[model samples]
Target chain A: MTSPAGRRKHGRPTISDVAALAGVSAGAVSKVFNGTGRISPPTAERVREAARKLNWTPNPAAIALRTSRAQAIGLVLTSSSPVPEVGAANVGLISGIESLLSPREYGLLLNVFLTGHHDESAFYRSLAERQRMDGVILTNSVVGDTRFDLMRDLGVPAVLVGTPWKPGVVDYIDADPPSAGIPETVDHLVGLGHRDVAFVSGPAGFVLPNIRREAFTARLAHHGLTPHSVSSVGYSPAAAAEETSRLLDVAAPPTAILYGTDTMAIAGMRTIQSRGLRVPEDVSVVGFEGLEVGEWVDPQLTTVQRFAFQRGRAAAAKLLGLLGETIEEDVPLEKPVLIVRQSTAPPRSR
Target chain B: MTSPAGRRKHGRPTISDVAALAGVSAGAVSKVFNGTGRISPPTAERVREAARKLNWTPNPAAIALRTSRAQAIGLVLTSSSPVPEVGAANVGLISGIESLLSPREYGLLLNVFLTGHHDESAFYRSLAERQRMDGVILTNSVVGDTRFDLMRDLGVPAVLVGTPWKPGVVDYIDADPPSAGIPETVDHLVGLGHRDVAFVSGPAGFVLPNIRREAFTARLAHHGLTPHSVSSVGYSPAAAAEETSRLLDVAAPPTAILYGTDTMAIAGMRTIQSRGLRVPEDVSVVGFEGLEVGEWVDPQLTTVQRFAFQRGRAAAAKLLGLLGETIEEDVPLEKPVLIVRQSTAPPRSR
Candidate 1:
């Protein structure tokens, strides 16, 4: 009889070796290992014992090919900037998603493409065609996003990380209404005796920005005040500076300004101070997204905080459930809230 | 007499079908597609023609299994924070790496593990045993790092993103010296009449903080001046605040302070203001790692800037070259430079 070590010296043990040692057919051993084609507990134990003795483990690549499971999740981002923004919210989202996925031994395949430089549609098609991921988490949904139709046509499972433009189009995880804190923000500014308040929003056609802009408008209307001015700009520092300058240069410039994101608000604050005006004294600034950097800035920004990390975890969990993973418990998402800091105060008399 | 559509109605065409149509063996068809096991150009053309006609594309999973090429890169980050700092440098690094890999159709597998929460060694072992990635990019090298030996034992290819502690252990890409900007930083402060200069560095054992501190010490000695104080702390806002306070409470506080990172520097600025002292007036401040958020701070941070994005691209390119991929061109790495902003100025008379 060949010793186990002597057998291993020839080559790595195969399924047949385990089956031969266990006095079973290769089919039985395969079934026992794959948990497919029912077998008796005693026979399974015998096969397992033989395999453990032989020191053989199934190849993951072979298993993936046979089972048609990639055991990975896809996340593709599109950015206009050469270096995509690594904002606190984005980092929190990635960390939250990994928090759950890592335990399950699933990998996250991340890709970022510069807008207009790569054909995103082709990439999605290749991913589906190659079956590279079991499912994907989509973010930054735009109004009338055709990616929904593309995913559906490709028969790919997907979950959106932002507000869904069309209800029932797909499952989504977002800050419940995303405008939950808008009313509070408006109330705070209005209570501060500011009649002229303006909103600087993200570019049009994005679902989140559009939703936020409408929320700001409705909240102002509820207070019986009309917006002094509203402008939409790209989510870039340059754009933020230019728009803030335009707002400040206006005759009878607004006493307070609300920005779509904390990053934009921070830039606006810089622009305000560079022009020799003080925060809250000349123009009170409010921002959305309670990023940690907000506190580091002078006059800590007063903004609405969204729990991106929790949302990311929820989205991943929902995707896992769709992929037939047993979810231990449903993760709850927190609502956005208004965090008042030194950046906002009563506006000075014009 | 079956049409291509009629044949497709049965199932997706396989390599056998292409071989049969091209009057060649399956091995020939595979070799032609994989660019392995040399075949005549005309024979390859014939095989390609048959595959195109049948609309048969080899399954990527099957190819990966047979070729043992995962065609992916791994990046694992260890952070003490729940949500790791998503600083501009980190974001740029990821973006830069993806800029090169995405075009080559290689996926990036990114994992973040919280320190002490997960067994990082076990993770690396699994990554190697499972062949989940062809190579990995490692960052945040420390003194006497054992990971280098582990990678060697596991036969895993790796590229370090920071300075390698031991030379010839693995290929590395870092800001040349990382301390290249220190001399200029010291010069700027000394020129501004800052005699009592101190350096607040990242925690001990981190290679970067150690190198920067050594550079600071040597430069001060060159100027015939001694450091007022040198304290090592964790790279956290809380740590920065406490250390700054401790330094201030001393009998004779340093007139100028240089921090290991921009985040810590920003926090120090806030601490200085909270104590009723103004920046660059009572005490001048400087920081390393010129993060974009630095510009958004009250007195825009003056610090040394490292091009993390470019380094990321260089690291990825090097890893690809190690994995036997044809690197088109070498990506040039930029040295660190001191960016003078509003934070640094002549100190006030004691």
Candidate 2:
């Protein structure tokens, strides 16, 4: 049979041809580029050389059709409110995923699903008709989500950034916002001789809210100390300042406070200084997100370094795995490290 | 003459029917909905009402083919070295544009043309041939860009977020970076008793660099006080801090600093404080970009409030204006206001 205009008379280069040229198996050739399957380093190199020499370009669409995938991945986030923290996080995640997908010839379709932002039916239609993307990476997953259900019913593969209560055999990469990072933070503070600590948390009812609070309480108990109080505030520096001022007014307030985000921590520290209180002496502050602002916030805040970019990379990897690429289980959860700066110290001996 | 669907075929709403129902011309209906013509409010409402009643759906493909315009818009941005500031700015711009396009049933295609980030040719080919977006939005335009040249050669319409010096008649919507915002900031600082002010700018050789520096010099002249110095640094908090530190160590330091962005202002403040100096009392600082963080930074930044949302809206309007709709030149140059907060004051009575 004659080949297409761009192909040789024997038809376009098949996996086998590429494999033979590379001195590797068809599977090894695929895995070499995909970062999966078993292949020696030399064999992998050979496969890449062969493919390049043969001018073989993989058809993503045909592969999608054959593999029953869309060959494109969806990144679902809300751009409606567009808070700075979430907005910055989204940027980091997108860039991270792009780092992986750019080389693989995979396309990312950003599907922002915000109620009241657009005609919901149009977005639904795009997903229902399989017109937009193949697999999806769901960020900020709310419990018992209809979007997740719809994605599942459509048999479209998806990976969640946050844990879903009933993800139902769906793949996911979750951050241990409560126990993993918080306990380590508490231990670090204790090591710094902090006996009285306060907890500042995000708004209540979300998964992170509950998880972080419990972790705070449990970690406090382990350290033979009860938190001065748990303060919950809206996500903003102004809100954090208002809440922190209340805690600072108490008769026996904590010497250190752990903040949910760098924004809040920055505000809290400023508020303490406004009251003429010193950080790490009269009061110490710890923050999450390791925002660059944390360093500029007077006594550079001591924070746990959570890899937002790596998390994004992991999310992309999980979605890719769901698309028939085998990924190893027991994948190492990115451990957050405490970057001790000027913000932490021993409580005053008095 | 019979229509393409045949004479006296079943009643299906056409552009002509929308025109008739709306009590306006067919061209007006096309302009209002297809983003081509400018129609009055009431007349546009009538056309929309008719289209809804008749359940008219314009064939996007046919429209694209006939007009040689893709019924979509391409947003071109860099993906390799993703600048969070630019990324955030683009997000605002994209979301605002989405608001404008969704009502008109136009699809948005986001393309990140990071050199070596992806298979760029395939993406360009698909965007040109398959995706077929009508026009493109090029953000952060560099001088003498090849992207603009290619779009022009392809006969596609384009609207730039920043000014373009490429050969053809290119249209753009840029914040009055030099004259409007940064100059006003200097004027405000000089008015507030800061005689020796410094300018901290983003990378040299960029479009805004020379414009902003000249504006600072001109504004200083207007105030009868020459600036101590102007320094160019990379677009990051760390870089801003390092540059600010150098400026502060000079023999005769500036009493105040004008930063290119809110993040830079925050960093500059920290650099001053690290030397046991206080903001306003020792060295006041001002910044650009009315980002949410501007309000939270300690001694909350006095800066120019460039309405990013409005900028996005204006860019979209300009794109619509280019699509055969007449829009006045004054509509695009919406001036930004100076948001004077607590960051500026009379130089310390030292």
Candidate 3:
């Protein structure tokens, strides 16, 4: 039994061999293989099958010369605000994008940029300078995003994962931040007989928080019960815990607390437990982002199920759509359905 | 205020404009920008300054052509088994790899293979045929991964995220699976007065499980306890719950449960809680894979902490090393330190 490694004695088959077998020039073979330069499908199939048989591989450069397409999509995120845990989201997004790109034989090139940072500006400058990608997908968009302007100005077709301030200028898909969504979450809490509610807002000026805060305040007005308080904290779970602790310790504390993200929700739950306070029994909690970890957290959190994976898939489809591909415009954005678990219930005195 | 959307008032500045100011040939300007076909350092500096003055945005394709290096790294993962949660680890790994690749001006090209019960032979064939990448990195290597062999045969510089069966044939960086480190964890348990410890394994026959099973059994003997039982479960948190319930139903249930993964540990904790059992007091639970969620879980799971990020960094470093960049061989193994949190404690009256 000869090892496959040793048996490959002829060395890697090249395009020249395929050309010889097909009785064509190397350029013709490359054009056929790359499906460019006007080869019939049948003829291209024959060349491909012959190449497969001979183990002939096409040099990507030669293919690049024939097609003039990079055959790649670029994934962009802020380098400074590294979301390590949000990897699942990234993965889900990538998976969704891959589902779209793979069939078309398009590859994905992930590019990370540091926003408002000097060192990372060079990185962004470098990415814009290197025209190796067909389109770019920007996740983690912020107000006044220079990346959006830069990508557009460069004539690079791009899409945003989150809704941008100026919607029409660039294509975007976003989880409804606060206005239409958080009211439903707060309303659900109100339905559960919770009078006073507190909110944990992650990074005040961030799009989601700004939206959530306004929604919470407006919803409180509708209920004729003002929120106990709205607290600001860093994005870290630890920061959520400290903020949650402060909110919980105040006089006339709320019976329900809402969190901007799932990680914060989980922290709030633990903080509640540390005080011998039972979830839903003593206080209720609602979280956003619907993270997978939220399911396993004790008293499995009641959360608005934001479909990041679906959104990622939608973003990929939209980018492809910009490339003249078939796709639906109405990507699902039904308000995050609240997954009521052990986390929310009637107020203690109800 | 013109929306940056209007076609740029002026066309992108060209190398000619830069060359006219730098007083160098277009080729010299190109070579200088590409860091290839280089001019003298002073001349290169002059070209850069002049290009900056003209606000020259070198054509990406032209630069790519002049440099010749693709400035791309192909990251290949099996599309079929991609765990969405593992996206975080993938993110960490990519971020680590990107830290190196980005500095060197290399792009990360992600390839996911999802054939849906179809043979992956075509995927491999296409990859072998394509040469858009300077090198490739294969993550989450499974048993009988033919990629290593294919990469070796192609003579493309490559690195593996998980250890291959033939270790010396390819460079790889991976966590020393808990099986290899089980003795230490088990010893810690024994030292803490634990007996009748039950071992929960990940889906059997995996590389991590293969090592863990042996180490767990051997470690039990070393501690003078016959490792009587081993339970294997699927990788999901739900599987952990089911397995934990079964383990606890026994007439002589173990006093301690060692979970193979953090997800399993959380599941097992839920299982115990559902049975009206208290963790540590009823049956101590220890989990592997010290993710951030572990801290948020009540009883703040006492588990082995493997530096998933550091391991990612090390893998990137090894690839850099293989690329003839200087890196130390004494790359540290991120030991799994047992975080003695609220989850593990001595049995009451075992």
TM-score for each model: 0.87, 0.70, 0.83
- Kindly list the per-residue Cα lDDT of model 1 for residues A1-350, writing each as its tens digit: 16554678899988778888888998897766544457786787787678767877667566656667666788766677655444456777887788778766577888776666665765676566556677888887888888878788777789999878989888788876766788888999999998999999888888888887888888889989888988889877678889999988877899999988888898898899999999978889998888888888888899988877788789899999898887685578888899999999998876
| TM-scores of chain B, in order | 0.87, 0.73, 0.79
Q: DockQ (C-alpha) of model 1? A: 0.38
Off by over 4 Å in 1: A1-3, A14-58, A82-88, A327-330, B15-58, B82-88, B327-330
Task: Say which candidate scores most in TM-score.
Answer: 1
**Model 3 - which docking category?**
acceptable
lDDT of each: 0.81, 0.68, 0.71
Question: Interface RMSD, candidate 2?
Answer: 7.4
Ranking by TM-score: 1, 3, 2
TM-score of the first chain in candidate 3 relative to the native first chain: 0.82
lDDT of 3 at B13: 64
- Candidate 3 lDDT, A1-350, residue by residue in tens: 13322334757766666766666677777775554456665666667666766765665555555565676788875543542233444656777677667655677887655444334444555555665777888876555656677777567888987767566768888766535568888889888788889998867556556767888899889989888888877666678889888877787788999987787788888888889989989989988877777777778889887777677778888888786666644456555677887799899884
Model 1, position B157, has a per-residue lDDT of 93
Ranking by DockQ: 1, 3, 2
What TM-score does model 1 achieve against the real structure? 0.87
Each model's TM-score for chain A is 0.87, 0.72, 0.82
